[model samples]
Target chain A: MDNFDKIAVIGGGSWATAIVKMLCENNSTIGWYMRSIYAVEHIKRNKHNPNYLSSAELHPEQLDLSNDINEIVGKYDVLIFAVPSAFLNSELEKLNESLENKVIFSAIKGIVPETGLIVGEHFHQLYNISYENIGVIAGPCHAEEVAMERLSYLTIACQDEKKAKALSKKIKGRYIKTKVSDDIFGTEYSAMLKNIYAIAAGIAHGLGYGDNFQSVLMSNAIREMKRYIKKVHRMKRNINNSAYLGDLLVTGYSVFSRNRMFGNMIGKGYTVKSAMLEMNMVAEGYYATKSAYKINQENGAKTPIIDAVYEVLYEKKEAKDVFEKLTNMLD
Target chain B: MDNFDKIAVIGGGSWATAIVKMLCENNSTIGWYMRSIYAVEHIKRNKHNPNYLSSAELHPEQLDLSNDINEIVGKYDVLIFAVPSAFLNSELEKLNESLENKVIFSAIKGIVPETGLIVGEHFHQLYNISYENIGVIAGPCHAEEVAMERLSYLTIACQDEKKAKALSKKIKGRYIKTKVSDDIFGTEYSAMLKNIYAIAAGIAHGLGYGDNFQSVLMSNAIREMKRYIKKVHRMKRNINNSAYLGDLLVTGYSVFSRNRMFGNMIGKGYTVKSAMLEMNMVAEGYYATKSAYKINQENGAKTPIIDAVYEVLYEKKEAKDVFEKLTNMLD
Candidate 1:
């Protein structure tokens, strides 16, 4: 028997919907815990998420939609936490009793603000879970692309090799590709840093900078990622690998990137607050920049790009002035 | 005293113009060798390159535009060969009598067609020039962007550590950034392979593929590059480094990329011959694909991407069918 016959996905975002849709291909029953009762009812009745994944049709039989977190949490052997970084702690707290002995996977891609901990790290500490039971889905995959069934690749990272390989096999399919790596910290750090760079890329685009400038920013961003990943993980990671630089390049340049789009709006002369209000959707980079800036300062890691982004987004510095400073800073 | 004061750029193309302009900033007198007397007169009289770099103004007083290969070869202590890869041998033969004791630096980035020899390797064999006296400039730097004063980086590869460091200092300026590496073959190969992939990226865009598919192609191209680089050089290269994958990503996705533009035309149902006829300039990738394809076959290197490109370009394979085959080939 496979280790996981029943998988529970917690969240109602586009990414959560894509994961559920992908998992259903495994021919296993899926439990989806949505915080909004209306969203759950809508998904149950329509067999589709109208707000996020409107194009992807979910089979009604394969989905177990609920607002009661306990019912879904207790029923599954594998638990996938797909909530945003800010809400992960509250959601984990609600499911703490039911998480015992289940394999927990985190699809959240940011560091928690107050504690400055990655989602998996937080789960490990609060739930007394071994590293073996924790896996992180760090991606070159995007929710928008997943809906189109375009080919995408992801890294499933865990400290325990056996657990990592097992999770890799579980998610590998026609449209979705999975690779296993032992450097959970490296994978997680890359995922977070990419969001920060995407914001910087967006700001450049908003500033009316052409493709020339955008390409330069992305190249430098990846270099910064390499330096930070080395500092934090102290592991041998191929910075050139798809999981690291490849993911950063795609997200930084893509039109559908929310963080880049947010930065672009701010660069086009909107205040950070105004941009956020306009976007309606949360730009993860806004939060990620804060967390990364603090972490870099505390850890003595050098990240000029992230610092410049923080200055623009939080310190109310002019985007053009910050960009000029960034260009001049390069030797 | 510096070993070289006056440098001759033996090709009046965009790359040569950009290199000459950069060298001029270092207080070095540049002799720009052009085969066309009309081009020489146009550059000298109007302070502009009529054919290649029309947008950027060149100061006539700073440049000695000439058709006399002997005069250029005799006056300069260092020669920067910026000729097209196909014409390198013929150009060198023309200047052989005047080439003595002068260091040679190749800016061309391709292998010889029939011999499968890198440009630097050909120089070593034909001129009996020691590897210590030969250097290569390869990286993410584009001629058009360099002329526009955009920030760009290059790897200066030479077997002699002292010569490499000295040359790096000579060219390091505001727009041109330099790094030193010993892997000449790897650097040259990276430069060549990136063009091939840029064509592939262009084809993807031409076929109306979104960023999702393009990212997947670029990511896989980098992986193929890493594998091939290791196989050829037997040295470890960081694909995430600015020299390898960085250059590839910039060229593959940028709008200013000529190779990608050419590939896009072909992918949009234009015949390869028709695309070439329509283009105002030569796309180096079209030539590189032929050279690399031949080399890969001879060396038994697995490069499905290059093969697919060759098939599409020369064998009259349909773009849609080729792409379907490529995706099917991937796991």
Candidate 2:
């Protein structure tokens, strides 16, 4: 608790609420921040998140709540950012406090739009945060499951081995299991890429492809992921690790994945804008497809799944035609 | 088509019938054997299988139907065994002719119970057949989907490269795509191993594990598979190949997979005997698990999935308790 005592979670989504719930199991007190003063007041009075994970109660005495980003950033030694990447830039814009020494953990699973880099890379280049101080929280674990207290596993990745193990202990509990790893680049990229694959899975499902096809699609997708990440980072780690393959499987197969949901709507013949309007939350894969497509153009990895999703979501190509072509490309 | 002209399918199940159906599309004449005299008559009279994939029509003129194993084996240059592995030995016992010169292709996905060998191995060891003459048909393709004429892919694996390619062309059609591989050992073992994993997937689903857990289970299952296969038969094969990973995914996730269905029942509190009584056919994984569990005792691969499933199915351990322990073993 000595090292973990001053941790804070940013953003007000379901994942942020879930992260707070996990941290509270080990540490008695921590900080939380949200932009909405009204939501802050609502949680303080009601003892639960008003919008997400409402069943997970928070102790008012344990939580240091604030509307100003700088107030929480100034106080906490460790910052866990859980905001959607699309909005991450604006949140960091309000941070007057320097994060050079503070350890930062990212729970966000997208590339920052302006930089087209993962949250950790964005912070390292833009905020002058060292990679050694950057950490990532990855999962096959879903927030709804954590709220239900079902068994879940999390991978805490950092360039600093000691920091990773220390953070892993703070998050592990009765239903939550944690593993520590030093491959932060692989974990973060896998997290980002899985969302795109999930969108691919959802699109296939929406187009009425059975579970048989879904499984084959996933098999090919993981292989493609191995190829893509190898070209980008070229690490010695197994992609089958929970941080990579397990995370990909969950996002691709789980009903909780919003990227899959967005892809499903597109496969069902909704235009991208209509699908986004229907779902109030942002789907990171929609933004990720563009960034990944641009990145792959330079790197030149053979990614049929990503290309199909990009064609459907960005180029306004027919989902049926793209997926039909995709089926031939796979297996 | 000319080389595959003397080909015969040596089983009466849905998969055997599907094979015969695919072969007939390319060859002008093919042989089929069903041990059931009743099923043979039913097919001849009704133009389809009486018990399995009943919708797939067969022309009596195109098929050389027989019940005697010796007649089929003696006349056919290539013998494709599609019978359930549990009954394969007794069926083979009826054959008086040797398989020394015949090309043996195994579509069966279980170890011969008495011999404790796969169908190809059983033929190679007992009938003095060569590995060069042994072949395996691997699939993410389900027979029911084939009956529905859905597009599907198959991998024909043989030690002899030319034989593998020749068989691939015979099976390739408008609805089916075929790829040839020379890794006969890797493909056959993976084909057998996938059924066991499918049962594990089913058991988890039956015990109320969600897709997140299933994906994790499957991801771990694949790695475990890679580990186990490497121990028994070291090779340069990618487990992600359609023959390995694709086949495993379909069996583990597909609704049509009897192995998964058998596992689901076990997880849903049915005893082994009760689950077997409820289902009419053999679940190959039930037998594969026992054989694999025995083999791994010497191989010493750390297979928590196989061990947990064996405990639940054979050792009579409680599914809930076994799976709870399995959660700790996974990530």
TM-score of 1: 0.89
lDDT of 1 by residue, B1-331 (tens): 1476667789988898888878878854688898899999998899888998787778888887789888888888778888888777677667645455777888987766545677888878876787878888876777887778766777788878676777788787976778888777888888889999999988877877666567767877877888777777787666666677677877898887889999999879988888988996678888888878776775766777888899998788998899778865542
Candidate 2: tens digits of C-alpha lDDT, residues A1-331: 1265689999998899999888888888879999989889988899899988999887777788888999999999899999989999999988788786899999999999988999999999888888889999999878888887777789999989888898898899987888898888888888999999999999988988766577678888889999888878887988887789889877887776899999899889999999999998669998899998888999999999999999998899999999999988987
lDDT of 1 by residue, A241-326 (tens): 66777678779888888898898899899988888889987788888888888777867766889999999988999999998888
Against the true structure, what is each candidate's TM-score? 0.89, 0.95
- Go through the candidates in order and give each one's C-alpha lDDT: 0.80, 0.87
User: Per-residue lDDT for B244-326 in model 2, tens only?
Assistant: 88888778777668899999999899989999999976788888889899989999999999999899888999989999999
Say which candidate scores most in TM-score: 2
Task: Give candidate 2's whole-model lDDT.
Answer: 0.87
> Chain A alone, TM-score for each of the models?
0.95, 0.97
Locate the minimum summed-lDDT window of 10 residues in model 1 chain A: A208-217
lDDT of 1 at B259: 92
